[model samples]
Target: MKLRKLITVAMACIMVFSLAACGSENTQEDAAATETTTEENKAEEVEETAEALSGTVVITGSTSVEKILTDMIDEFTALNPDVTIEYTGNGSSAGIKDTKAGINNIGASSREVKDEEKEDTLAEEVFAYDGIAAIVNPANEVQDITMQQLSDIYTGKITNWSEIGGADAEIFIVSREESSGTRSAFEELTGVAEAGGLTSSAAVSEGNGPVQAAVAGNENAIGYVSFSFIDDTVKALKVDGVEPTAELAKAGEYKLSRPFLFVYYEDKATDAGLAFLEFALSEEGQICVEDHDAITVD
Candidate 1:
């Protein structure tokens, strides 16, 4: 009887050990299963975030900023295949008016919003800075001019290139139209009156390309254009001894620079508009600005 009782107790101990082992195995399996489920859920969330967003964004404004903005839009749309962007290169004033009137989703301007144009309902975002290059014909020997000299030249006080150290030739000034953002920024930077500080004497070009063409064709012509527009056709002169470069402009060393702005009405903005604006302020968008020869804002 005693041997039988001892045998029974040993069997019971073996059974308990077996049950504990089985429980331990099942607990490990359950934990592994839960970990796998959590990983799968995290992967799904990542996939959802990577999905392309869809919408249409409408941009209208400054012709000076059109090319850069278009380039950026192209890159943005490439990443988000479902999104479409339309840009209209009217003048800056028209862009502001259209934004206020709710005709466009966003207004692009190369200049900052004037105090009078600011309203509680309107918002401005500055994404980049652009240097307004003072260009002269390649044949002209004049290399640099001071801000005061530039102001005087635009104001018609210095009519000959010889007055500021150049050849004995009359200074033929080329200027953008009055409605141009480039013209506005140039006048404000140089503290010159409207019409490129001219008294109806300067030749008016409709756009940067035309202004470049006019200056390139005339040996004695001088004009201010976007830094991106400067090429072999014209020589970009240093102002106040500081070169007009995007880097210098960003560093605040270049005085003839202006902000690249996007204006919109807060109440009128669509989801697509808001998304595009966010993208425009993203790292990728700022890279696009740098690629287009503009200074990105920090």
Candidate 2:
């Protein structure tokens, strides 16, 4: 009887130990499951935060660059509804100055930053190439002109449209205002040297539209503007029989064409700016430009 009782006690102890082992294993499995759940919740939160990018960025300057920003606003807002853009066309010089003062997130410039500019707060990106075309009233009937002829007209060297194969009318030269990048480009090509160097004889206007308007409204008037600015209201004079199309400009066949620039403060660049620039340089941005009758870098 004693032996039998002893054996029974041993078996009972073994069963209790086995039960304890199983309980411990179940607890370990439950703890592992809880840990995995906690990790998954944290991952979901990070994903949510990354998707929520929002802010306002402002850009101002060259009216020539306004179209690109117009295109960007539509597409960028569509992709990121939380972001907003505000822009203005105060001319390229105004834009550059505003960026330096930190009043604007970006500045638009057709001419590169000149060495004489007081501040060095700009970082630049090449956006597109612009062909500055010499325009005259459609009724003027001027067919062709060389670079020399253009310079002569602006310097009062050649006053009559007839000298360049047009009607027998005095050339009404409409020029760009001092702050205009178009003026800078015109001066560079015509050897006026700087903004104020235009001869006293040529008439001056404030913006591209005014230049076009001045020329279009007056049969004897002539001025220059970007190829994109040419419309039915004015005529685009041929330079050496080569038209100012984007393809011709890209090949450097158009003599007066120059690169356009998008400028910003280096310190003002945010994550949004980096992403937006990348998008603009990508296939999508190029496609937007092509659709809007503007040139792309490809």
Candidate 3:
């Protein structure tokens, strides 16, 4: 009877050990399976978030800023394939108007914001700086100019290039539209605004491209444009002996410089719009700005 009891107890102990071992193995397998599932879930969440970031962002404003902004858009869209950006090369004033009316995601301007436009929730971000180059026909002999001379020329006081030691031909003045940011900044900086604005005889172009074209096509025409827009087609004259360049603009030596701006309504901003602005201020975006001949904000 004693032997029988001892054998029964040993068998029970073995059964319990076996059951415990099986339970331990099952628990480890379950933990591994749970960890794998959790990892998969995390990956799926990340993918979903990426897929959710899709939309169209509309940007309009300064024709002067078109080149740099287009380059930035190209790079940004490459990174975010789902995000679409549409840019229109309206003048800066029109851009500001669109932003104020919530008609565009952002407005581009190459000039300082006016005090009157500062009302309400209008916000601005300075993305870059640019010097306004005073361009002339390459055939003209005048190599440099002064601020007073420019002001006088635009105000119709100086009508002949010979007045400033150039060719004996009459000076053909090219001016931007009254609503142009470039025109505003140029007039304000060169004292033309104080002199009652551009003369009536000046040919008013709607954009920088037209201005450059006008100057390039005429041997006696003079106009102002963003420094980035200067090409071999036109000759950029020095203002007060200071050359219009990104380096000089950053150092404050170029008096014709202005800030490149992004104007938007804070409350009405969209996710993609904000993201695009953030990217424009990023290092990569600044590189694009510099690459396109604009001075970086940094």
Against the reference, the lDDT scores of all candidates come to 0.87, 0.77, 0.91
Model 1 compared with the native: what TM-score?
0.85
Number of the top-ranking candidate, with lDDT as the measure: 3
Q: Give per-residue lDDT, candidate 2, residue 261.
A: 71
Q: Pairing residues by index, what is the TM-score of model 3?
A: 0.85
Q: Given candidate 3, what's the lDDT at residue 145?
A: 97
For model 1, the superposed segments whose C-alpha errors exceed 4 Å read 1-52, 194-196
Model 2 C-alpha lDDT per residue in residues 1-298, reported as the tens digit of each score: 9999999999999999999999999989889988999999899886674476568778788876666668877787787777777888887889888888777887778777777764565678876767788898888778678877777777777888778777788888888877788778877876666323667878877778878889889999889987777899999988778886778878878777766677886667766665666667778777766664556775
Q: How far off is residue 187 in model 3, in Å? A: 0.4
- In model 3, which residue pairs have backbone atoms overlapping below 3 Å? none
Q: Please give the RMSD to the true structure for each candidate, in Å.
A: 3.9, 8.0, 5.9
| lDDT (tens digit, per residue) of candidate 3 on 1-298 | 9999999999999999999999999999999999999999999997886677679988988998988999999998898889999999888998998888888999998888898888677889999988899999898899999999999999999999999999899999999987788999999999999998889999999999999999999999999999888999999999889888889888988899899999998788887788899999999999988997789988
Question: What's the best-to-worst order under lDDT?
Answer: 3, 1, 2
lDDT of 1: 0.87
TM-score of each: 0.85, 0.78, 0.85
